[model samples]
Target chain A: MTPQTGRSAGPGVPRGDLPHRAGATGWFDTRHRHLGDWAFVVNRLSGLGLVAYLYLHLVILSQLARGPEAWGGFLAIATSPPVLLFDVLLLAGLLAHAFNGIRVTLLGLGLVASRQKALWVALMGMAVLIALAGASRILGVTS
Target chain B: MATLLQTPRPGADADPAAPARTLRVRRHRRGDSAEGWDRYTAPVGPRTTVLDALTWVRAHLDASLNLRHSCLHASCGTCGMRVNGRDVLACVTRLEDLPPGEVSVEPLRNQPLVSDLVVDIESLYESLDGVRLPLVRTSEGAPGSTPAEGVGHLTRFEDCVECGLCVSACPIVASDPEYAGPAVLGAAWRLVAEPRDRDPEPAYALVDGEQGAWRCHLAFECNEVCPTDALPAEEIARLRGILLRHRVVRWLQRHARPEEVQP
Candidate 1:
């Protein structure tokens, strides 16, 4: 949380979290938000989830330190139906975040600002199709 | 301001022939610790605006109910508020065009509340001043129209209207109070795009930083809620490109030999 530059509202006058202003925690408050709002919230959430998964993955890979028996036991748990279901969801999150990230970067660099909504829909559509294919491959083999 | 303390309009709650709707308005006082809503049932015809409904409430139901409006048109931008969770000018938002049901009218978000349905707009104006863009411009594409006797072009005052609707609709502004929001950036872009008689490089320099234009996440909610179509999101991106190209040129200049100075 780096410090922001000084604001014009000055410093001391408290800016109250007025209702319907969608405070810091209200990014996901989807009453009448636009598609870009939803895309932004989804991107942030998926990024956070991915970061947490990275740490868990390192710990899971540490099973090798306990010898071959421990590693095999972990692999058995990993291949179960519930674990495979989690994998499918994880793939969806990754694809959604990655594709939207590309769109955000392109727009931020002033590439295509006019058709941003259309660009978002196109990128997310591709993400959905890829996620569906990956989910079928993962779940179908398990079942 | 709505005329208050007069005899209550007869059709507010008693008439059986006129159409009516319930308005769920957010209420807050200066010293109140929390906020809540007060529902007022007002007699509304098809063309009755949200401002008209609110004024009706002030006249017939609750005299203490507070709001602000000047020109009973969208040009003033003083009647901005959220109707059905979207920012709009209350003077133009007719009841018939809104989502059918009890309409929820809340004050603009992310700013301090002065009273019911009116936020303290001092900060919004202060932010505009910080950018230093004169809020006036010539109307575009008004060709073949008459100009003043000595003037070359017919000029219009402004289009942005200083409504703060873009600021309210922006999520970045909601999260980071210091972020130079859509309206400011939009003005900055205009300054840079057409400097007129003045240099715009300083205006570009003002917004080259993180809290300036780079902080935007391209939500484009500002563009959506902007009543004037100023397209702040697009302008912010343009500002970023200018800053990026300037930096690249400076870098090249630094690394170039003394021959680069001969030109």
Candidate 2:
């Protein structure tokens, strides 16, 4: 009996010509979502967000070198409620990124790498706890 | 043979009169053909696995349906395919785990397609050949003659079954064909980590390239899809750590002993 070959191209046709489909995205494929994958996605997004915020913060701080008037004008906008809320978001992103970074480092060190799911849960739990505490302090919601 | 193929689901209520389930297999006539998929409805029950359905279809409905499976159990690792868009072992995946609609079966990814539901896994094995995997014991001691105190508990490192499923699930291998995949790298780590292996330098050289451990994005899909719990992603991470440590040591040595460092 003739075997049913999966590929239909002739010998002369290059393999590259065939349709080659990778994951749903280059790295983030929602179709193959797992717990570890979700963690990776969150870590990547948070890291990028933190890097962008770093550059933005530096740009804003550079205005201080211009003059007191310029600095005071920028500070006024920075201290606004919307800016404060954005700071809170940045704080949450920073905490998540930092904690997840620690988790990845620990995994690299082979510390509790076998129980990665548990480690992720524990790190995420810590991130949430720290973010909540920081948010409470930022909003003056103590008590 | 059909009776032997029946694998009852765990804690599943036995139903003798269950209705038949459909196994829709995606077919490609050649590497560039446009033939999409072929559907086959078989008399499936709770005990039927994806492999059993394929076998039934081949034996009864379409004799031309090509698939490969050796050990009906998960040991042989020959029946790896995509079921419902996820890489899985056909011999072990049960019908109950699939959704309510028709079960879809496709060939494994990151490899050349041989036929319907059959891929060229020899490419994976060929990649392993470049790593030079062999126990390199330099000491002229007999087997089991060396001290087994700390080395006895290293069974976790030797869990690679070389199924190629990890290669299929690995995104790096899909994106970059030159990248030595998780399975081969995991095997390299296993060989290198063995205390009895006196010469691990070759394995180190193999993994110290651009397509080595650094290429992995730590997606952890290989660990998730492995049926034997090999944890290849963990092994790759350990390999990266080892490589990083070696690089650091070499850098320090070069800086400290400038006379000994060769240009």
RMSD of each: 7.6, 6.5
DockQ per model, Cα: 0.26, 0.27
What is the lDDT for B109 in model 1? 86
Clashing pairs in 1: none
Clashing pairs in 2: A4-B115, A5-B115, A6-B115, A7-B30, A7-B31, A8-B30, A8-B31, A9-B31
The runs of at least 3 residues in candidate 1 whose Cα sits more than 4 Å from the true structure, single-residue gaps closed, are: A1-21, A141-143, B1-8, B11-16, B134-142, B145-158
Model 1: per-residue Cα lDDT at residue B83: 94
Candidate 1 lDDT over B165-262, as tens digits, reads 88888888887877888888887776765556767776766688667888898888888888876778877877777678878887888888978843
Question: How big is the positional error of residue B53 in model 1, measured in Å on the Cα after superposition?
Answer: 0.7
Positional deviation of residue B253's Cα in model 2 after best superposition, in angstroms: 6.2
Candidate 2 lDDT by residue in tens digits, A1-143: 23345345677865442233474354566476576777777888888898899999899899889999999999898878898788889999998888888877876654565677888888899999999999887776884
Encode model 2's per-residue lDDT on B14-112: one tens digit a residue.
344556677778765454455457777666776789998788777766776889999898888889999998889898899987888878888888877
Residue A64 of candidate 1: its Cα lDDT?
A: 95
Q: Could you tell me the lDDT of residue B117 within candidate 1? A: 90
Residue A119 Cα positional deviation in candidate 2, in Å, after optimal superposition: 2.1
TM-score of chain B taken alone, candidate 2: 0.81
